[model samples]
Target: MRLRRRVSPLKLAVLGGVLFMLVLVVLQRDVSGGIQEPWFEDLSNRKERMLELVRGAVNNLAFQIPGQPGTPQLPAGGEVDKNCPSGFYTQAELKPWLERPPEEPHSQGAGGSAFQKDNLTPDEKKEKEEGMTRHCFNQFASDRISLHRSLGEDTRPPECVERKFRRCPPLPTTSVIIVFHNEAWSTLLRTVYSVLHTAPAILLREIILVDDASTAGGCGVYQERR
Candidate 1:
């Protein structure tokens, strides 16, 4: 019989909190104008309800499966210690995955070539059409790109790079939540890696992923690894 290992309920609860925080960040950041009185009041009133919904969603997303013996958790630490000196988390968390070699020219979407059109053979066209029909996009083309594709360097201006916050009140670390529904495997993973690669571990607490009841074959692989 195959062995199954489940992530603890405590861990799943933590996952819920991460997602909850992410939702709050989005709502707060995307407000068209500054927070008005009525909006703030409504948000305050619904805060408990939102927490309940996030807990339910996270529990639904958690799963049990045989553990992969050697999969190292990204940004391996559970939480960033504020007391640590500058660059401590950066040195610890920036692994070889972020320093990947450049993709070959033959790789789809490499070197800004994704926009270039290719003359498709009849069979290729039929395959592309079928992929689009099933996933509502070109899954065939997406399959050709690496999941860990490089997105090039961070583009911060020189002034932004030079500015530093006070050590006494270090910037708060954040958890990134990615919610996907039947997304292409390559695109989904590329997004995950992109954040991991770009975001400094000093300011990134963790990544929480939520799959919203996806029934596509592309999601099967992730489910199997749960």
Candidate 2:
């Protein structure tokens, strides 16, 4: 006798979220001025509706998959303790990590370099594009690794680290969603983390990444560590 595989609700929810993200990625291309929420255009819109949307997505991705004991729950508001690593509920609660010192400034790098022939190996195929130049290739590349190499660490400015600049609390948390197709792994990941690091942790709720079915094969050095 053949047995049917059983799937849990949590799995189904995650699948729904992934599918939803994928759809949004496709829909975004069709919209001008980028994808925007219709309700957010007017203050008269119910804010809770947005939260409900977040709650739906959160429920899908949170908690352990199938066979797990933990269940998702909302956090009660209280005195701000620290940043919100959860990337959803606690963003409004984050204050400057004032106790920590400011980060050093990042130094700018050289002008640019095109994808050289020697750099293009058999493993990568992106260079095969007709008449592709270095400038065009670098334009699409990420500076995440370059930044780390040139700037040591903690490259944030004094204002970013100082708590004196903070506005009153009770701010709203947000979910970050990114959709891309055939994006360089390094650049795409850097974009993801740049958002995470630049924003106060408390202000972030969750980060959603959806692939738009990329076909960029590889770009030699770009793919080296992505």
What does candidate 2 score on TM? Answer: 0.34
Clashing pairs in 1: none
Instruction: Write model 1 residue lDDT over 54-84, tens digit each, in one string.
Output: 8776643331111233322224455545554
Top TM-score model: 1
Candidate 1 regions with alpha-carbon error over 4 angstroms: 1-97, 115-117, 152-157, 222-226
Candidate 1, residue 161: Cα displacement in angstroms equals: 4.1
52-148 per-residue lDDT for model 2 (tens digits): 8988777554352332334333356744435533323333445422223333343233123222334655534454443235334553334323422
Q: Write down the worst ten-residue block by lDDT for model 2.
A: 107-116
Each candidate structure's TM-score, on Cα atoms with residue i matched to residue i, is 0.49, 0.34
Give Cα distance to truth, residue 87, candidate 2, Å: 23
lDDT of 1 at 223: 20
